[model samples]
Target: MSNRPSPLNDWQRHCVRRTLERGGVIAYPTEAVWGLGCDPWNEDAVMRVLALKQRPLHKGLILVAASVAQVEFLLTPLAPELRQRALAHWPGPVTCLIPDLQQQIPTWVRGRHASIAVRVSEHPVVRDLCNTAGMPLVSTSCNPAGRQPARSGWQVRRYFNDRLDWLVPGELGHERKPSRILDIRTGRRLR
Candidate 1:
């Protein structure tokens, strides 16, 4: 990652960080679509996201980070080659599921699985949101179940309206679709 700050201005970053700290859900742009996010450790926030999506808790959520170091606790235990493989596609749009072997991630984020999906995003707004919040944020498509993921801020507002605490200003990256998901342990593409 670069030493420079994220494109989000100081005030926007401050508000985003504060919202996450207060367990408020936010909507921001991602690699291919707008995303809803909140502090992953806050069950209330996570549950709120599930509720907004009309998604069952068993469906799980993805965690978006500013850097690999933000997820070292989950990555450190993997075999070196496996770790390398997972790292290679990151700082970009690929989401990979790593075994939550120690059960470190909350059940709300991991759902019924023994793994959690994560990505170190290259999207400026995503990195800014995660970095401003000082941790990974629960990232799910900003649409109710069965709806197409929102591709613009206007669509995000249409889908969620006043329900979101803050809508971080930004645009989607160049990716034409959502990140491809893979199970790192099995090399299987889940999406």
Candidate 2:
């Protein structure tokens, strides 16, 4: 596994990073499905994600990170236990709904919710993508609202059909379902 080149070759990584910096959306593999992602801070890029998915803006989005450190700006203000609670699931497939107390997350990502959905992904491609991007990327299943999430690169191409700025080539992780979402405050499962 260590011999693998962090999912993308240097040149491929560069192009993807450049595309993201320019407010472009990309499709990539996640734990159980292909995902659409863009720089969460770029409203235009985010809007394009919603448009591609034919999803409503009010539905919000998930932000996937390479590590907990990338999101310390949002996590630092929480109670230690709550902070640890969210951190404990790091570099894995659990998505936690953390309170946006500092309001650091933009409304476009938070949508109508008071909290933000975030995950520290275990999938190598996702982690590498986030690391290369130098921050979290907005993550949502790569399919139209009513369709099943794409589980293969070919499926991703069929759904987006040259629409995405880049498609990171990789395989999905060993999971049969999307990450389980939990509300950090209530320990309630949301999905």
Best by lDDT: 1
Q: For candidate 2, lDDT tens digit of each residue in 74-142? A: 898899988988988886899999999988988888999989999998788998899899999999999
lDDT of 1 by residue, 129-189 (tens): 8888889999999999999999998998898889999999988999999999988988999
Give candidate 1's TM-score.
Answer: 0.97
- CA-RMSD of model 2: 1.7
- How far residue 35's Cα lies from its native spot in candidate 1, in Å, is 0.2
**Superposed Cα deviation of residue 181, candidate 1 (Å):** 0.3
Looking at candidate 1, what is the lDDT of residue 126? 91
Off by over 4 Å in 2: 1-5
Q: What are the per-model C-alpha RMSD values against the true structure?
A: 0.9, 1.7
